[model samples]
Target: MRTSGRRIVFLVGLQGVAWLLPAGTIIQQEEREPGTSKVKAQATISIDAGKLRMEQEKPGEGKSVMIFDQSKQVVWMIEPAKNSYMELTAAQVQQMGGQMQQAMKQMEAELANMPPEQRKMVEQMMKQRMPAPQAEKEVTVREKGQGEKVGPYTCIHYEVLTSGKLTREVWTAPMDQTHLGGAEFKTFQALGEFFGKLSGQAPKGTWELSGMNQMQGFPVRVLEYEGPRATSEWMLVKAEQRSLDASLFTLPAGLKKSSMEGMSRE
Candidate 1:
């Protein structure tokens, strides 16, 4: 689904704030193993008013390309822009996963120590600060199709019912070429059940689905369902699996250092 420009700005701001926190403070974390890559894949997303098309390719080490189209015009492109030495090994990815698990446990312990009223207040604050839900509840899976000859893998298709009752479908294949027919079916069923509970309404908390994609290249996930308010269709665009150049993950260069100094003064 194509997101409106306003929604893009809002999400970018939200992500910026999220990145300000230490990695250990993240609510959810997934480790991407090094050297994992997907050859190619396509995703067609539909929502209330529009649809988005995505094509991705990982051609070499530390390089990948993502092309997004909405309403038949190329809207966005993601390419390798810079380089850094912060690459991770497979073992390190596993360790990071463990660290994330431990961090979540610690956070739960701390939250448990809070008084009842304080915890309630905290929950309320979190809900109030939450972003708009990306996927509308009207979304439905109409028909699913699969293929077996795609590199020792199979593709799972999901039919999405838009708010206007229009049906659109998307096909996903594993980046690692692993057959995920059973798992994909289960995931779709579970997602449908969860959406059914909302009664075509948005909720008041973030909903996310993260894991590997069809090609087994890199970890991919969805962070569109944010709360009761529906997000723009554009937010549903799928990202590809590939090594993200370290520079893209870091703060941009050439900004005046005085901004930090001024914040300290305040």
Candidate 2:
């Protein structure tokens, strides 16, 4: 229960901001996380001044979409497989996150009052039930040098070290060159600031890209490896500026719109 609650808080905060830009479509190549598979997935991220959407491409799979509307301060997770969309407001998300944190604090208080052995058993049971966490990764990023083409443009290279071991190389080109600048960039910044407060922790890449405001450019390619094995890579395949139809920012017809608050109340 605690884990799921934490996940909700994290997801609500992250989804509200992470993927965004101007009126354009960005095609990205996403490989499964390390140890999963060699197969890759294509994702289309579309953004306009007022909204953002991400759709993963897969054969024989029903359409799934995550849409965020900045003006409304809401997010919609659409599942065509189920013919439904789940929505959450910024206020509701923050309130739910606060509830989760308070519940955890109360749990800690109860744990403190319990006998040592009982507390240990409870923790052990929790560990056994939950999935193992990913390797503890402390990411340190620095601009190192230059690199070859990333997508359509030449880029500068940056290295990512996880727990002091170099594990990733990133290539970046100018943000404007990606066709996402001015108003859209400002929208992302606003979302970042808004969510950073609710999440209590800044997103990982957010910290790594801190000074990019003055430096320019965003990561266009990221190659991640584990030792000699190539774990994963996500690269920007295409980007262009255009006016996205407003309908694309909303749920499709015949699908029901639902809210987290209503479900929780029920």
The segments of candidate 2 whose C-alpha lies over 4 angstroms from its true place after superposition are 1-28, 32-38, 59-61, 110-139, 160-169, 190-215, 223-230, 259-266
Q: Which prediction has the highest TM-score against the true structure?
A: 2
lDDT of 2: 0.63
- Could you report the Cα RMSD, in angstroms, for every candidate shown? 21.3, 15.3
Top model number, lDDT: 2
Listed per model in order, the count of residue pairs whose N, CA or C atoms clash below 3 Å is 20, 0
The residue-level lDDT of candidate 1 at 22 comes to 28
Per-residue lDDT of model 2, residues 177-211, tens digit only: 77877666665565554454244332223213333
